[model samples]
Target chain A: MPLLDLRGVTKDYKLGKTVVHALRGLDLRIEKGEIVAIMGPSGSGKSTLMHILGCLDVPTSGEASIEESQISSLSEKQLVELRGHKIGFVFQTFNLMQTLSAQQNVELPMIFQGMKKKERAQRATELLTMVGLADRVNHRPNELSGGERQRVAIARALANDPEILFADEPTGNLDSESGGTILELLKRLSTEYGKTVIIVTHDPDAAAIAERIIHLHDGRVVEEVKNA
Target chain B: MLKDFFMLAARSITHRRMRSWLTVIGVFIGITAVVALISVGLGLNKTVEQQVAGVFGVDTFVLVPKGSFGPQRHAGGSSDQYALDLEFLKSIPGVKVAAAVRQRTGFVQGPTKADGTSTQGFLPVMGLSTELVNEFESFTGKLTVQPGGRLFLPEDKDVAVLGADTAERLEAKVGDTLLIAGDANKELNLTVVGIMAPNDEEASTGSSGGFSAGMQPAQSKDTIYVPYDTMSLLWGEASDVLVTLVRTQPGADVDEVADRVEKELNARGSEVSSITYSDISDAIGTMTTTVSAFLAGIAGIALLVGAVGVMNTMFTSVLERTKEIGVMKAVGARNSHILTIFLIESGLMGFVGGVVGTLAGLGLSALASMFIGRFFGVQMAVVASPALILITLAGSFLLGAFAGLWPAWRASKLPVVDALRYE
Candidate 1:
């Protein structure tokens, strides 16, 4: 069974009197250990799709399932549980809490999972070390570089040992040099960790690092390209 | 989970240091007002109790003509019309001794002669039987005499005893001769046989410049004492007893005695009422409680205003952290977690305010008591129990939590997608 499966998913938002179709009849499947990119221009519903897959939102109609559990059928409380344990999300802004240290940011998801303090601290240190930030564990977001911030966010995403990881425009706020390093780190996550990684980006260079690229236009998949 | 939330809230409050401090100050002002005002009021109640205990002995009751207990009515009456049946009062089982007292206001010429003119002032003149004078001395446990003077004898007609304050004001020693102008312009020259000790009890009950309409000034420090025969000589045959003092036997119920006296007076068709010392004490207690509650209520308004300030600050905090709330939600925080975090933050603000305010209030009460003691000559004791402090702290904390409920709920209910998109 695929790690993530979606069949005829649709999302609609009401903008005053008019209905805005953010997604329409979207179908996708992602298996374990696969790196895929959903590439689209602005307003093509890339973020809406990421939100639905991450369990931050539910589709208006149709089916979305993670492993054997139907996402659309889960209650809000169950969704929160699934999101905390089964999935991880990294945003374009690197959303590290400014007041927390890199180590604390990484330990946040584990804290929600009711992990003991000593164990979560140990896990956070290991994760930050894996992200090449061993020396910067105690540094807050403001004290870190753009790439370091994103790395802290990625470490936080991996805190619960999630089965799948989602990155939404992960390199949008970084320089080209730091952006290259981030893409390389994401590729290593899929290859060495055997985790299903999904990246939603409009930049072709960021999409090139993924093994599969699904092109979306007007909220629909128009092309599929297989890279090495 | 609660610990984590507390840590998060603490971090948030510390991040915005200035706003948090200002909010705390607002609550501090309110709590301080409540603590200080109520404590001072309680102190005043204690002072009044002490004064009443001193002036009217615990076992002594007063019998006055009906409606004459009121100071305004007492001033309007002809003393000749109000007379207590001393023999009948003494006939009661619990009545140990009964003494009829005649009180009148008169002008006494002082020993000081300014340009050959004697200084005179209005002073209270009390006419008492020698037996009653001895009872008063025994009740007070102190002899009413100056350093080198003696109390007047029952048959002494031309000798007088002056209160310490009156002696000081009149510049009259124990051997000096003073002139007194009594009712109907009757004049008498009497030798001062003794000078009484200064009465601190009178200062507490005397006119201190507030609303004292229905209350009459008790026998104060500025008074002179004479035998009943001497008073009769000055006022002629119309001198009637003004009030009667009844002493209850040791260990007897004063309330029962007072009730029996009232019943007997009513049975004999006498328009007189008897009041026990406990009755006066009870009235004073009720009045003090009411005044304290009223003052506390006014202070509570300030606390309510402080609560509003806390709510406003929490609402602004929620608005500013919209994006952060979205991030937390996306990272798997439940609505309850968000609610707990914000509530903890606001509640901590209130708890801290309570602690600081209680301390500040105690300090302010001490300062006020010092001022009162210096100016009014009455020592006030401020009361602050640990239980009261704990209640105030808990109450302030609950107030903050209540104030933050709506804002925290709003933050928790915000749509994740829209919140992330907020600037």
Candidate 2:
């Protein structure tokens, strides 16, 4: 079985008196260790798809499966547990807690998993060191540069050693040089660590780094391309 | 997990120090008012008990005219008409000694000195039987002649004793001649055989009503005492005994004696009521409880205001940390985790407020007691028992948690998608 599977998945939201369709009849499969990008325009349902695939939301109809388990039938608490153990999310805004140090932020995911303090601390330090922020472990988000904050967020996402890492416009806020470094780090995460990676973005340059690109338009997949 | 939530809560509260402090101050003021008012009320209650005990002595009861205990009623009749049957009162089962006291306000002239001038003052003149004078001496050690003076003997018909303040005011000492005049314009001459000590004066004065009257006895600092026979001789058969104080055996039940006295007096066609020290002490206890409860209720309003203030602050905190909450949810924190964090934060605010408020209240009570002692001549001590502090602190914490419930629920129930979208 593929790492993630979706069949005829549909999502709808109520905007006051109107029903807005965010996703309609979507079918997709992502294998383990694949670097895939979901590229679409602003209203093309890329974010809605990411939310469902990450277990942060449920589809209105049809089924979504992570590993071999069906996600659509899961309760809120079960979904939270699944998300904590199986998926890691990196946001475009680098949403790190301002009051927490880099090491503490990285340890948050494992903390929720009830990891032992000494072990989580050791893992947090190693993860920060792997993200090239070993010297900045004690620095809070406010004290770090934008790129460094994003690095800390990336380190945090990998804390639980999730099966799949999801990045929603991960480098959207950084300059091109910093954004290039982030994309390289994400690419290496798939190539070197054998972790499945999903990136959602409108930037072609970001999509170019993915091994597979799926283009979405008006809540439907329009094209699929495999990069050399 | 709880520890993590506690740490998160602490960090959040510390992140917004100014707002947290303001919220705590609101609660602190409420708790302070409650603590200070209750402490003072308890202190006053205790002081009244001590004063009453000191004035009335132990195992003692009083019998007063029936309607006299209500208020000073001026019925259109002579004061001499309301007299108790001394024979019946002295015959009560537990009566060790029943003393008949005739109280009157009269003018007494001090001795003419070498310069031929005398000072005069209107004072409460109590006429006691010679036997009762001895009872007073036994009940309260040595009522007359503190050091250099003489006690009133059965043969001493026209001698008088002066209260300490009255003696000082009249410039009269032991053996000084005093000219006493009754309200009926009858006059007599007597020598001051003794000057009573200041503390003894408070116990010797006659309290007109029983304990239920709740009246502080007339200040004995300015008064004179003469034998009841002398008062009756000068005023003729018109003199009446206003009140009779009956003492029970040391181990006898005072309340039972009082009830029997009332029953016997009523059967004899005498209109009178009786009260014991227990009655007055109970009344004082109830009065203090009511006052404390009333003041605490007012302070409770302030506490409710403080709770509302905490709710408002928590709501604002949840709003301010919306994005942070989203980030937490995204990082695998459950709704329960978010709820726990916020609840702990508000509870900490209340707990801190309780501690500081208790301290502030205790300090204020101390200061109030100092002023009360200086101005009222009564020492009032704050009852800052550990049990009280523990209850206050725990109460404050629970109050905070209760106040934070709605806001914390709202925070926990927020959708991760919407929270992330919030700016």
TM-score of each: 0.77, 0.78
Candidate 1: tens digits of C-alpha lDDT, residues B1-423: 688788888888889999998998888889999988878887788778776676667788877676565444566543333555556668988999886666777888877565676668888787766766576543233434657887768679977788777888888898888888876878899899988766455533443422211112233457787876677777764235666678899998989988898888768765666767677778788889899999999999999988998899999999999999988887788888888889988998888788899999989999999998899787888778777788889988988888899999999998888888888
Candidate 2 lDDT over residue span B1-423, tens digit each: 678777888888889999999999999999999988888888788778877776577888877776554334455332333466575677778988887767677788889978989998777777766666566543333354568986678888889887777888999998889998875679889889987766543543433222312111234557787887677756654235676778888798889988998988888776667767787788899989999999999999999999999999999999999998887898899999888888999998998899999999989989999999899666776789888889999999988888999999999999988898789
Residue B415 shift from truth in candidate 1, angstroms: 0.9
List residue ranges in candidate 1 displaced over 4 A: B53-149, B152-282, B292-301
TM-score of chain B of each: 0.70, 0.72
TM-scores of the candidates, chain A only: 0.98, 0.98
DockQ of each: 0.58, 0.59
Measured by lDDT, the strongest candidate is 2
Query: How much lDDT does each candidate structure score?
Result: 0.82, 0.83
lDDT tens digits by residue: candidate 1, A186-218? 999999998889999988888998899998887
